[model samples]
Target: MLSVRSAAVRAQCPSCGTWSSRVQSSYRRTASDLPLSGRAASLAERVRRFHCDGAQRTRRIFAERHGEEILAPFARRTGRLEIVVHHLGLALGGGPGAGFARRLQVPVSNDTLIRVVRRRATAKAYAPPRAVGIDDFAFRRNCRYGTIVVDLENRGS
Candidate 1:
């Protein structure tokens, strides 16, 4: 367990983009961090809620922005911890990755690991075949016919 706080005197409002030093209230947020010395580790941060002073009718009160590079809003785990989990899910898959994460003192479910993989997936663009080669073959005395398509550019089927 580790306790910390942001040293910045003021934080910029995410909605209005105005820097505010007026602190409305403060709260503590906990997030799971990487293991330390083979033991589970956690970080407790004292977050401050600021009153937006911008003229724009945006949010009245907003919490201090903990940059996404460190931890995302409402995230239960640190950014680095999530990265490790993402890699584990990609390498070992859901079931095995969850088991490995448990061995590393990271508490995560197999379903969560699977969700992480799905959430991070990106759609790949499909390209039309540039050069195609089509051929027909007879299985037995022209009784059965089969067609084979190959990409002539890459020389692959």
Candidate 2:
């Protein structure tokens, strides 16, 4: 049983970016949260599904946008928690990151940690550079070669 529960109301649909007062349905979402006082915490988020206004949107219904700082759709952990876990995964390897999460009372596996890191990394937006530097290097013993493209503005690949 969840100790804490609440309902969220949103006048806007994130998908279609339109307002809809007609609630299609609602559901409870269990989001793992940061541990409190050495005990694991979670939230029974009563998420509302709103009927999208007819604006040529593909999705007829869209779930209410929850606190973006808290979590996202289909996310198990809070956004802040995921950020910390991602940092841990970046600092440590997969196996070590898993072990660290266990100690932190965040039940995350090695595979989950890897996924977190990959997701956050890909979610970032990099500004397009005016010019890019391209270089070629042999990847294998005179067999395979790979091209390295570096952004001149950010010096990132």
Candidate 3:
């Protein structure tokens, strides 16, 4: 296990975007990180909660926000580790990715990998098709027919 902590004494409010240093409380959050020395690693982070004194805002208290590139809010893994999992799931698929991760000293389940892939797929933005092509195919020599639509620009069907 690797211990870590945010060095910033102040954090910006997610609602009112005000920087605050008055700490109301602190807590520790543990998350999975990249492997170290060919072994799975975890990060124990010391997180701080601040009292949002913004009188105009509805939120009276909020947790400190870390850099998105470093660690996402309420995430179970570090950003870099999540990126590795994402690529592994995308390239090798769920079961294979999970197996490969185990070999690399990364602890992950096949279902988790599948979920990561699904999340990534939903998050990605696809460009609108500029042109499309349609065709009909027979599955059983005229007994069953199906229609197929293809994006001409992206070459996706």
The order of the candidates by TM-score, greatest first, is: 3, 1, 2
Of candidates 3 and 1, the better by lDDT? 3
Who wins the TM-score comparison?
A: 3
Q: Which tens-of-lDDT digit does each residue in 1-157 have in candidate 3?
A: 9887888889988889888899999899889999999989998878898988786777878898677566788889988899899889988999999999999988999999989889877876788888999999999896999999998888621
The candidate maximizing lDDT is 3
Ranking by lDDT: 3, 1, 2
Q: What is candidate 1's TM-score against the reference?
A: 0.75
Give the Cα error of residue 54 in candidate 2, in Å: 3.7
Which 10 consecutive residues of model 1 have the lowest summed lDDT?
119-128
Tens-place lDDT digits, model 1, residues 18-119: 999999999999999999999999988789999999999489899997776577889888888888888899999999999999999998899999887787
24: Cα error in model 3, Å: 0.6
Scanning candidate 2 in windows of ten residues, the lowest lDDT window is 1-10
- lDDT of the structure predicted as candidate 2: 0.78
The local lDDT score (0 to 100) that residue 22 gets in candidate 1 is 95
Model 3 lDDT at residue 56: 72
Residue range with the least summed lDDT across 10 consecutive positions in model 3: 64-73
**Model 2 lDDT tens row, 93-131:** 699988988888887899988998898788887667888
The alpha-carbon deviation from the true structure for residue 53 of candidate 1, after best TM-score superposition, in angstroms, is 0.9
